[model samples]
Target: MALSTNCWKYLVLTFNALFAMSAVVMFGVSGFLLYRLFVYRHFIGVNVEYPAILLLMMAIITCSVAWIGWRTAKSMHHFHIVLTGVLIFLVVAVQFSCFVWAMVVWDSVDIDIKNSMTSFFDVANEVNNPNSPESIRWDRLHVQKGSVPFSCCGQGPLDAKFKPYTADCSTLYQRGCAKPLHQYTRQQLLMVAMAALISSVLQK
Candidate 1:
């Protein structure tokens, strides 16, 4: 299907806008995380090296891709079919990788939460013995951990009975709970996949 010039223009505009928005989101998230790392040295701990760098790199790459797409939109025939195929493949690969990364991070965070909870439970049980002052400290620590909810979902442990956490976590946990984070991550990945698929179809 040969898209009209006007339609192509609109597609380019839309694509550029989406990429710009994504860039902003990436920077914002990464900036906040970096700030947290600065303020609370151990907030996310030593494992924090990848996410910030990845977000910044993604923003840069998205901007570059958007620029290329915008510039090429007006001269679609200038590129050979093989080149177009390569671009399409890259787009799909990038989006898929992003989806996988999000899933992995989400899963990691979930595991951390679970481990923390388990430790809290153990400490709570030990502290409840009534004979140790350490028990009081353990109870306090348990309360603190329970009070702290997963940052991604913004739902505290107290709210774990709610919809997204209850339903989404179940599916995510069943999916090996290793790299995949949450159902939301899956949804985001699907959106990226759909965008790439649609763009490829339209280009054809």
Candidate 2:
């Protein structure tokens, strides 16, 4: 079926509106992630941050693209239309790149988190100076972050003790946080994947 000029214009406007909304959504999500990492950057490495920053940039570009799309819909100017098309392509490209980058970071960070947690536990156990740089950070992670109540001292019940530094000492949890944290990371990756699919398919 052939569409009239009015139908095409309406379609473009509708898509532009949706695109703008997606930009806002991406901005919120990426901004939140960036804020979280900024707070706990000491605990988690900055590797995952690259994708998040890229997503933030993508959101900004997407907003520009959507604005251009909206104006192009009204004026139907050749140059504006061409610019909007190019910007749309750029948005999708950046989104897909970020998705791949996120997955790669996820794979590496999961393992690194466990080892890092173990080291933090070790640090908390060995280091007597509570005010030391490492101790301060781990203390916040342990007691403040509820790391102790959340899980056991080590990987297992008989593994070792994570005491002295921590205030809690009555009982310990046998389950380590690695599996649970891994699941959470998987969930985040799933969200990224879904967003990438929506952005690529619908936007394209």
Instruction: Give the winner by lDDT.
Output: 2
Candidate 2, pairs of clashing residues: none
In the range 97-160, model 2's lDDT, one tens digit per residue, is: 8778777877787766666667766776687675677767665555544456333333433335
Using alpha carbons, what is the TM-score of model 1? 0.41
Range of the 10 consecutive residues with the lowest summed lDDT in candidate 1:
175-184
lDDT of model 1 at position 30: 53
Please give the lDDT score at residue 58 for candidate 1: 55
Q: Where does model 2 exceed 4 Å of error?
A: 1-4, 36-39, 114-128, 144-146, 149-183
lDDT per residue (tens digit) for residues 1-204 in model 1: 455767866776676667556656655655554454333222223333344445446556665666666666656555643354466457556545554554465446544534544565467566666445445443343344332122222334545575443334443323232122223233433444343334333333
lDDT (CA) per prediction: 0.47, 0.71
TM-score of each: 0.41, 0.69
Query: What does the lDDT read for residue 160 in candidate 2?
Result: 55
Which stretch of 10 consecutive residues in model 2 shows the poorest summed lDDT?
150-159
